[model samples]
Target: MPHFHFHSVRLVKALLACAMLLASYAGAAEKLANVTILATGGTIAGSGASSTTTVGYTAATVGVERLIAAVPELAKVAQVKGEQVFQIASENMSDAYWLTLAKRVNVLLAQPDVDGIVITHGTDTLEETAYFLNLTVKSKKPVVLVGAMRPGTALSADGPINLYNAVLLAASQDAVGKGVLVAMNDQIHGARDVSKTNTSTPDSFKTPELGMLGYIQGNKPYFYHVSTRKHTADTEFDVSKIDTLPQVDIVYGYANVNPVALNALVAAGAKGIIHAGVGDGSLAAKVTPSLTAARKQGVLIVRASRVGQGIVARNGEANDDELDFVAADTLNPQKARILLMLALTRTSDSKQIQRMFYSY
Candidate 1:
């Protein structure tokens, strides 16, 4: 009888310990960060006919709910909710779309229940969208943009792990106030510096010059740096009241380039033009007159480099001061166009815009 009683007591004690452990786990789960994934439809949501198909797949076919379902492990990192913001390939991303996405991000971030946001986007314009949100999102909470080169149906699709890591970043306290970030192929890059470098590789998005913000290892994000440029809550850009963004265009420069494209863009009601000039943002002599003419007509001209990865200095290749132009200062033509669009919304003063170019 005594032996039986002692054994029963041990069993009861073990049961109590297991119940306490379960309760502790429940408490920890309740404390998990609430991350909302605003899916913008990309290769991450793409699907192909066969598991072997990687390149030629229909993108944005998979919905957000299925994407969240595919990655059940997301529950382990954070309490995730998915919202389909847009279902178009990021290459089709427009200014109106930018306004909508930015406003939605602001709205969600304002909610007390929301913790952070992860945007699943197409690789084509992922960097652009990320940069747009980086400038306009009005919160310090982490906003992570993630994409995959291989479609979800591919043999070894990268979307699941990328999505998982993005959620990890979104839920992390370390990611707060880091502006906007892009997580791809296990690397973290600042939105301002990251660009899609390759057309179809998983490791395509890269910050060629300034380097990436950090990297992910063993499903954990490790930070090494953050962007020095003003972003997110620190930016003066606000699209809540604005309906349409000003028309800004990009003009590429090459050897013996003509000014017809420049004149055409200006005539087409371009409020601003980004000259993707060659080598240090140099202007082809033939194009200078047209740019100067457009400048005189109250059109903003920003000289950016076509060389892909270099700073466009104020007086390096062109006399921006004399022409009353704004140098892009490391911003590529595409990104320069985005900044120019937002800058035009505030002030068209070249000096003020010039300061913006430097500041942002």
Candidate 2:
């Protein structure tokens, strides 16, 4: 009966091992971070006619819940919950939407259970929205923006993998206080520096001059750089009480540009106008008269370069100090418009506005 006792001891040891395995898994599950995905429909939610179709597809066809289901691996990384914030393409993103989104993000980040947030957006205007949130979001919690160049129905769909990496980045403690980030094509970019450079490729978003903040490898984010400019929780811009953003418009500069466009925008009650100047943010002689007139009318004028990568040095091409114009340092025209809108809400003094441009 010694043999029976020996077999029973082995059985008991096996049961104890099983229990330990189960306990370890339970501990890991409990440690998972709680991440909420705020989905604003874009190509990531678009669906084509067939798996091979990429272009000419219907965008915003899928909802947040469906997008979440498409990426089952997201569950392994975090306790992810999806919210259908808006079902329109990012190109249709409006200032009203920005206010609503910023408010909602502020509210959610205030909760104790929320560890981070991931926003699904369209590549077209993703940089603009990311920058806006970078300025407005009050909390230090990680906020990530992600998008796909191809529709989800394509044979080599990239949405699912991109979503997985974004969730991973958001859940990481290292991502906190780094400002809002854009994760696409396995690259992590700070909102202020990144812009969509390509039309249809997955590697569209890039910070060509400053380079990416980091990159995602093996489902983890590794940092090499962080934006030194003020962002998130540090900026003076607040959207909590703001109902509507001020009217800010952009004008392109070219050889012998007509001044009528500048005059028309001022007549339309634009609070701020960004001249997308040519070469070092130069003000053409033809449009200078109109700009001077607009400035006298209490309109804020900012000169931003049309070049993809370069700084619009203050008082370089034009006498910013004398002309009372603000230069957009290292900001593209589209992003310049965003900062000008927020700056107008606080003050219109050219000096103060220029300070905001440099600080943000």
Clash count (model 1, backbone only): 0
Which regions of candidate 2 are displaced past 4 Å? Answer: 1-24
What lDDT tens digits, residue by residue, belong to model 1 across residues 134-169? 999999999999999999999889999999999999
Give lDDT tens digits, candidate 2, residues 261-360.
8888889999999999999999989999999888988899999989978889998999989989999999999999999999999998989999999999
Any runs in candidate 1 off by more than 4 Å, and if so which? 1-22
Q: Which RMSD values do the candidates have, in order? A: 2.6, 2.6
TM-score of 1: 0.94
| TM-score of each model, paired residue for residue | 0.94, 0.94
